[model samples]
Target: MRNPLAAGAATGVLVFFVCFYTKLLNPTSLPAEPANQVARSINAEDTGNNRMHANANAHISWQCLSESDLRDSINSTENVIVVMPAKAAGTSLKTFAKSCNPNTTENLQTLLSKNDAFNLLTKSWDMPGVYASHFWVPTALSQLLRSISRHTLVVYIHREETSRFTSAALHVLTQWCAHGPPKAQKNFFDKVENNNHKCHVREKKLVEILKDRPQEMQMGTIELLTCETYSSIEEYAPNMLFVDYKRANVLQNLLAERYCPKMTNHSHHIGKGAEKVFVQLQNGGTEVSLSEWLEKKSSYLEWTLGLNDKASCLVQTRTMEDNLSTCDGSFIHAQAVLNY
Candidate 1:
């Protein structure tokens, strides 16, 4: 009774669509490329020990790269990707990258597909160098490490988790107050109290905003991100270095000696005048020892940062007597402990 040819064609169309949608039609296997191919391709041109190109683009800013630029950079075998996140000595690293023959990008999703990523690393044999922001995106980080030459030196800059959080929170507050009404700005410190219902509501809003990002890009504690990044680098890249944010100056000098020997030293830009403001906010209305203030907010701080209770003891023990120097001192001490 039914038309056999029409029924058969309909079934075929449905099967094809299913295969296409499920990626069953796409090739699942790719020829394994030697990691040395990437290194050889990138190092084909010996730019001398000082890799800084005289005519290297110097229009450095905290801007993401264009899609076209990103494609070109990742595909080009010449660039070394630098993954530094916000409030993690990014400005200093940016300066370092710009000083070298490095292409910088902030777009985290530039290379999303595995095939394209593989081709980008294996195909291109020409490029000066690249320095890009990976932030804390796990998938992108994995793909990036896999695509780069095994010999490519991957760099990561990290800060102490608690100090980083405090700085980041203060930065957010500063930005919010800058654009907010004068009255609201004046009351900003008061609003930070957990007992304030409005503050609690704002915290919820912040969490929701963070939750809206891609799972890999979700806001995480600095410790968690650092651990993940370290693990990934260990698995993928053999040649890599982790820079401490506190000793960024030392790392900057070392990086210059290795990559841009001729480059001049540039001081870190952020957190210059922030220490005073940070002290004020943390102390609230009254003067208190760094240990006392931190101890008072121990529970809230631990919960907010997803830290273990023992972390409070470490924080308290490490707290400096002088409030003025405590913020900076704590950062240095934290890095020393980690690096030790």
Candidate 2:
């Protein structure tokens, strides 16, 4: 009779070999990666076209870009530039990267390890045709971008402050603060045990950090609290493409358009049905939306309202002449509120 034990052993060996080869062939059949992790190139033709546009001074094609092309451009050239607000929801650095390439978990981990905005700048200054995102985009980055690129396109994103703050706080608690150095201990929380109080403290600290003159201004916890501040980026970078950060598919479409506009038209959220909403606490309203709460505290609104009494000769100044003309001799009440 056949040896039952020998037969069983032979079958087990064959199964193990098959399983090992399957794993070697298909790596992505493994577990999921972290949020915003790049996977692989979704489109190749678009990627090649974007690389050509990015490499030279040609017009951008509206097509889906591939991860390999993006990676090659980044690895090879250092001429192009991209700016993104940190902690933005619609399009983040990870989202942008994913549009071109599917980065692995290991790759993302390596990037996070070198998350310093300044360091990345210094290291990549010599490269060409690479558009990178610096979280804060410090003075060094601004100077570098201004120096190299022939045609620079600035994309600015606007979102309701409260939503961004909430997302940012959670990101800090979960990502940076959780694994950050001992110095970041005060920012992290173990759980939502007292999230209300924790949120308040975090907000206060953020506001304090963002406090200062315009030149010294920087995004902190509270800066993202104002819808106006995000939109007001135009005042700083006039040529910037201000996009509503709340729109879905914005980041992907933007990248696709930048690389290959014809094949993949990136429709801006500008005229899209409803605009982004921010609810303010009605001076004495009991229940106020988070967006409204942020508006009340944002420096952008504070500065605008504060300038009303000063009567500066600014270009877009709403002078008494404009207001009086609109009144047209009607019973101009001393106080008629115009909410727009």
Candidate 3:
């Protein structure tokens, strides 16, 4: 009532002290706009363009690797090397990898050494992995041995041997007869039948190679080479993943979810078109069914090797049924052919 200016000054000081104490007690109550912006920037960079980016913040539990654990390993690692055979849905794997991490390249044949492979793997700033399809293990073993790292993850995609052989053979046949005359198809068939012919000779050599060093052959064997390579790599690498081409569709989703978490929906359509071509070939034959045709081809391959049960050694009939079932009506046709 007496000194109004002095009283006002005292009130202002009290309010200031109260506000300071409140801020001190709850430091996080203030908005950190600059820090938030930086965090946002980093997240954007990590998730940009489906490119493979390093996950420094990833929580990796190596002791128990689930699908998520494998993904975390892939995301956190500097290199992921995938070895797959031809006609083993490698294209689908590549497509899935692109959707998950655009920073991947499938160029194993071109790389000479592990260092070269590593260089290619990290060519892009945020690359996740490098897929090397249609590769021979023996040829690339030296380089692969050289290129292994603590952060490296090696994956091998396995297919049924007989189905792989049939698919590869049919693929070659389809390509050879794509636009050619019927006579060209007959000639090609003749070449395949003749043991001395280039096709027959090559097939024979491939079988021998598979027997001697299954790892050297593009189409691996059931017994030695491929299995040995798999066991050896498991012992050598810190992280290794095996993808059965038979269950590729399901596994693809699991992998995509881990590597490309931001992607809402992902689908793989590799090798679908090839099914139509296979169906057309099956229907085109009037006297023999597609399975019979495949058998005849298998017989010829066995004959080249001068063995009665050589076909058994090359491919498993049960696996063939599972593989053919995926081809539209091809399995049904094969069953009819078998019955006839």
Candidate 4:
């Protein structure tokens, strides 16, 4: 009753002092969630209808890094391991790791680079200080790199499943034809072999790894490699990073430099062959649009071969030098046309 305004002002001052004292007494704790929405591919859960989007406000610690930043991380960390999944940008990462620090990187890479399982069994390969001899050897459903040191960084570069499968399929087809241009009657899928060190993530293997293995599986030289999918990567390593394969297409650039250093980036762009195709098609002059005409005619010059972007190198088996044959889709289609 004695000046309500004075009493209210006093109450406000008390509240302010209380809050300030609390802040000083105990520093603010980190938010409940860790790194948020960094991995748009994995941190995101699929809702439906074939769309990719991150979970809104989802708590996570995994960082999505660019090539430059990841290279720096690789250089700085005392012990680093890259999960080199096949048909992913692994070759390029390997190139960068070697370039960054040949000593530590080479020390680790050489132990298992031969990729000879029997040799691993028979030989007494000296273990690197860090237990990472088998880290990069990724098979489908493979466990990726992990680190206990908060200082250590673990990296996984992911390519989307379908696109990767297409690449693998193409590789197999190339291998089949490279053996000998097969008769059109032969079963293309007959007795296909598993990849040597090649893998694309498969849904089947992912389920097995999640259900079968320990959340924090450790590695040994004899360990058969498992390429880890994103869902439970945090369990394997506290500090995990997801490098989207498409975002970090450094392999192509590395290959370009190593193989054809003189060729500028734009030199790879489409040339007049494409323009000639368009012109010839236009000259056909169907009343219908040329695109629609091609659809009706069931023929169009296919350059990309389901390849969306320029690949670092068009993958081929080493044996191709000895036994090269045509695996061209158009050629195959020409053979199969009568089958339809």
TM-scores for all predictions: 0.46, 0.33, 0.48, 0.33
lDDT of 3 by residue, 24-103 (tens): 99997776669789888877654422223233332212122344455565577665666666667677776666656565
Q: Give the per-residue lDDT of model 1 (tens digit) for 263-301.
A: 646556553332212223322344432233444554476
The numbered model that scores best in TM-score is 3
On TM-score, the stronger of 1 and 2 is 1
- Give all candidates' CA lDDT scores: 0.43, 0.35, 0.47, 0.35
Q: Which stretches of candidate 3 lie over 4 Å from their true place?
A: 1-79, 99-103, 113-115, 129-132, 141-146, 179-231, 234-238, 262-265, 269-286, 289-291, 295-340
Q: What is the lDDT of residue 292 in candidate 4?
A: 33
* Model 3 whole-model lDDT (C-alpha atoms): 0.47
**Model 3 RMSD to the real structure?**
25.6
Query: Per-residue error at 5 for model 4, in Å?
Result: 88
lDDT, candidate 4, equals 0.35
Per-model clash counts, in order, read 2, 25, 3, 4
For model 4, the stretches where C-alpha displacement exceeds 4 angstroms are 1-72, 95-148, 180-232, 247-340
Shift in Å, residue 57, candidate 4: 17
**TM-score: model 1 vs. ground truth:** 0.46
TM-score of 3: 0.48
